[model samples]
Target: MQLDRLVARTMSRFAKGGLASLRPRQAPAEATAPLAATGPDRPRGSGSWANEWVGTKAAVERAKSLARPGRKRKSGKAAADSIPEGTIRTKPLMSARGVKLHNWISDRLEAEAPTCTLHACVSLGAFLSADTAHEGHDPLAGLVADLLIVDETGQPIAALIRENVADPSRHLLMLDALLDADLPIIDLPAKPTLSMLWGEIAETLPGA
Candidate 1:
């Protein structure tokens, strides 16, 4: 497949210089914090890192810089007609259901066997995102991952995304563009139960 030069550039950059370390082998700063315990009734913020589907404000900005599209659509519709491309307006774009779901995922991972292929297993709430950064021959840019997983070197291992609550067209566009770049994307329902999420993830679980 003729990948967009920009996408190639991103892959190359990630492979070469670690532009922005998304998820390395070591635990995230938050993961170092102690968890009170994993249970059915754990409070939201007790002993757990904040559930940031995106990230910190500074982190969000950094991610945006990397994912920003190279050029605007030339159609005469102006900015109004363009995709918002904004990942966040509020600090953390999470839902009540999402909070529980994310927490459960975090807890469950910690309870699982070691050497999990999904780095999220080691570092809960980890995320990965990619799109054309440079002005290469790619057609789309500013792609974002609600939840993505990567290896020690920031290479995309897998993409586990719940259905996007924003522009579906743009989300689909991003998925298509990512597929061209040879990244895999998995879709779950907007409100997947913990069991449902785990079931979906089981497919990607390669080794025991």
Candidate 2:
């Protein structure tokens, strides 16, 4: 009985503060961990610029919301993406050569046994809330995904980015924000073969 009681008391002390003592050492990592990324971790080259575009953009939106709380933004992104209301599309909504790559991805989704969903030109602003909130949250305002793969419940599971890498100013920012938002990002080149696209998509999915 004495040994059991002592063990319980020692455990109580450890539970009370032992965890907290370790937190200070982990503070910096924790500060950055809020930028949690999920899905395919692509090899962004060494030259990828580390900018605070997400926080800056978020701050701007927050300020706008505060100044005009009564004002509301419209849903014109759908029109920009050329997506029709009330329909599930097989291929991504695009008007360029990227159609081939987008089509390949849609085909892949259709073949999945459990059957994930495919969405084209998904507006990050529509589903993400970081725009009206604080810094560090990915404010994906005015950003769109080339394609989004969602689970059966309409929750985004993966994203495909078809970007012009020449413009890192926007592309890199989008990449970082998507990572911070905890969404998987797949980089599909404009002109990839069936095997090339498969490799890119497969790398991000589980087990590769």
Candidate 3:
């Protein structure tokens, strides 16, 4: 990776500065009142010292600044569409069913980049969406994915995938016998299975 000249210079300056404090400290003022726990000798408003007021005021200012409106945010759909380059999206090459295919893709992505988010489409009631943000499940679970797979029974692909990935979860065997009726599902090699599953992943990855 190449560094820009200005950025490199700034980093060098930081390195030379080490980890010491950079700002000048001001002197503390005398206390306005006695300790609050004390009787009438103490100051009013439950205050121990005037410095407390200064700290409180500074905190209030910071809170106000944070609460103020930032630059109007871009629309959610537009922001999602601006995904960075080199992002991999593909249908699963080896799975018993399409939902399994979706999970297979997610698992591979997690293996490649554990921190990268994975999402799955879900449906509730009569509507379908990638709104797993409100699912109240594991915090580390991937975000709601855009791609959705459904069987003739209308079961959400996300639910099935989540079940397969999470521990102590319900088992979901593929039951959609009709989907492969029109097309021939590719069969994995018998006995020698190592080459069958991983080969698909290798071919999909870059520089494979």
Q: Rank the candidates by lDDT, best first.
A: 2, 1, 3
What local distance difference test score does each model get? 0.50, 0.59, 0.37
Ranked by TM-score, top first: 2, 1, 3
Per-candidate TM-score against the hidden true structure: 0.43, 0.47, 0.17
Candidate 3 on 183-204: residue-level lDDT in tens?
A: 1122222222444654544443
List pairs with backbone clashes in candidate 1. Answer: 67-142
Per-residue alpha-carbon lDDT of candidate 1 for residues 1-208, written as tens digits (9 for 90 to 100): 1123334545575567542343423336563534444788755543223322123334545544544456445664433313433333655456667566666665665566223433222211133233443545334445556555554455665676655567888767767666766766667577666676776655554453
Question: What clash pairs does model 2 have?
Answer: none
Q: In terms of lDDT, which candidate is stronger, 1 or 3?
A: 1
Q: Candidate 3 — which residues are off by over 4 angstroms? A: 1-81, 97-122, 125-208
Residue-level error in angstroms, candidate 3, position 60 = 47
Q: Write the per-residue lDDT of candidate 2 for residues 91-204, one digit (tens) a residue.
A: 635766766556667777677524576778878776555754566555576677878777766677778887857776778878877888898887776565677767666665
**Residue-level error in angstroms, candidate 3, position 148:** 12
What global local distance difference test value does model 1 have? Answer: 0.50
* lDDT of model 1 at position 66: 45
